[model samples]
Target: MKLLLVEDDRSVATAVSAILTQHGFEVVHARTGGAALQALLSNGVDSFDVILLDVGLPDHDGYEVCGKIRRRTETPVIMVTARSDVRSRIHGLNRGADDYVVKPYNTGELIARIHAVSRRNVPPSGGEVRHESELQFGGVRIELTARRVSVAGTAVHLTRKEFDLLALLAQRPGIVFRREQIISEVWESRWDGAERTLEVHVASLRSKLRASALIEVVRGVGYRLRAPSA
Candidate 1:
């Protein structure tokens, strides 16, 4: 797979590029945000499978670069940063990065994240299945294909995880799900079975689904998607 690596630091860029190349990914290194934008507009955007972006660039921040790129393509983006704060991660995610990796991160872990995001963005291979275009509960309607939500026809933005969790719950309302089950359903099989991660995702879902109070915490049992009428 071809990958674009955008970082202003020369040493880091070279090191990461070499590592990715060793892993069999064709790497295009961009040292500045402007140059990165130019590369994408020229050829990288259409050709690359993934973009590894640095949050703090000499010319422009990664957030701006990510936003600009997203306007043009839905290519997967993974933000690379030295910052570890929750706010920074949230900011990167909100700006449209598919995933965020702290700098000084393990290369193997980074590669795993890249693969996971790439897999999620790809269209599923093979065959027909029962698919629903819209799911409705408690006056809320979620459009699965568009990844959108409407409460009484008013729009709302849900983070990717929140949307996935909500969609899973909406598919089987009143059926309780263990955290592990939900995690396995939403995340790919390669992900570590981390219950804390599931908890965080569920919390985010609850926050976004605030108008309906549709998600019910079941104490030690797990959680249930309860409609407002329930």
Candidate 2:
């Protein structure tokens, strides 16, 4: 698949390019945000299958570029950054990026994220999904169609994975889901790293819920959605 890589650091770019190329991807490298935008706009539909965007661009902030691209296209943008904080990840998702990866990322993990994002962006076939209206509990509502969550009439931002995890837990309420299961449902992949991703995502969800509580972690087991008020 053809990929647009927007990175200014030459050494880092070289390393990433080699890795991606080794994995059977034809990468179009761009050193500046302007050049990246130019390449994207100039190339036709089949030119690029995905974009690996560096958050710290020499010419412009990756978020700004992401916002612009989001306005024009539905191409998946996977953000690569050194910022590992949840806030940074949240910011990238808010700007329309499909996935986030920190700098010094594992090539395998990056590939997995790419595949997961690609799967998500794949348009649904034929007819549409006729599903439930929403999931409501403890003043929190999840709009399935809009893919949004609101707490007590206020919107609470959540990453795509976070929403998926929440939905899975919500569906079964008190039923515990193993970390491996959570990973499969949310990341669209099997267990890796002893389920650190599941743990991290749960922490993020807890933070978002703040005062309005739900979602419990069963020690040495898994997590379940249980009303905190209960």
Candidate 3:
């Protein structure tokens, strides 16, 4: 797999790149945010399979870089930073990163996350779909083809993962979706680390939609969508 390593710390970049190379990943090292963006612009968005971006950069903040990247392409990005707080993690997600990794990360876990996000980048086959073009629950409308969501005619902005999670549950209302199933399908991972991320997205969705009753928690298992009464 080809990867773009966006890190200002040369030592960390060298060590990480070596490890990734040892694991068969072709690494393109970029020391600054502008350099990373230049690489992307010149090499094309599809050139890199994954981007490991450090939050600290000489030219731009990783969050800004992530936003810029999102505006250009749907390429997967994993924020690698020393900011270990929950707020930072959520902020990274809100800015359009596919995943977040703290500094001093476990190599195996990071690699797993890398593979997981890459897997999610692949569009799902139509075989397992609910075959619905759009799903509606009262004022909420989910457009699967357009990947758009709106509430009562006002457009509701959603990150990619948030939309995926909502689409999965909305497709089959009243059916309970287990946490593991949701994570595996939505994040394309069986990693335990993603459970917290899933919860964050759910909470964000509830707050954004302001329709608490639309998604009901099943206590121990998972979440179920409550279709509106006719």
Candidate 4:
């Protein structure tokens, strides 16, 4: 797989690129946000399998780069930066990143996340109500077969996790899905940090749908998708 490493620091980029290359990835090193964008422009949209972007770029912030990438392609993006705060993570996800990995991360875990985001075809099956080929929540349309979503007749791009979360909620509208249940089904993990990731995806979904009330939050409990009215 081709992986793009966008980091201004040459030393860090070199190390990461070398490591990824050793792990059987074709690593492309980009030193700045502009260079990264240029790489994509030169190679076309589907050239790279995954992009590892740094937040503190010399030319443009990573979040800005991520947004630009989303407008062009659905390639998986993993924000790799020193900023580990919850706000920064949320901001990156909101900008359309597939995952967030803080600096000094474990090589094994980084590799795992790279593969996780790259495997976008797999769907999550939890203990929620089973869904058919399509589901509707007012103006939002979900195509489970194709893993596609649209809002008010307009196609909307959703990251892998975002689609999984929405699909889970839409399985049985009006059924309150517990937080643990969501993480287990959508993420297939019992990791403690997954709860926060769930929250970020939910916020992203709500914003993209433009129907704040479509997904009802059961405070101190979980969330449920509102069923269409008669």
Error of 1 at 117 (Å): 0.9
Relative to the true structure, candidate 4 has a C-alpha RMSD (angstroms) of: 15.2
Looking at model 4, the pairs that clash are none
lDDT of 4: 0.81
Over 1-83, each residue of candidate 1 has an lDDT whose tens digit, in order, gives 66789988898988888766655467888888898888888883566678899999988988999999888778789999999
Measured against the true structure, the TM-scores of the candidates, in listed sequence, are 0.54, 0.54, 0.54, 0.54
Quote the positional error of residue 203 for candidate 3 in Å: 47
Per-residue alpha-carbon lDDT of model 4 for 82-181, expressed as tens digits? 8989999999999999999998898757876875686562223332244479988789999999999999899999999999899877865655566766
How does candidate 1 fare on TM-score? 0.54
lDDT of each: 0.76, 0.76, 0.82, 0.81
Off by over 4 Å in 3: 123-230
Question: When superposed on Cα atoms, how far off is each prediction in RMSD?
Answer: 14.2, 14.4, 14.2, 15.2
The residue pairs in collision within model 2 are 81-103
Q: Estimate, for each residue in 91-171, the C-alpha lDDT of model 3 and write its tens digit.
A: 999999999999899876686687668767742332122457887789999999999999998999999999999988876
**Would you give me the overall lDDT of model 2?**
0.76
Index of the highest-lDDT prediction: 3
Candidate 4: how many backbone clashes?
0
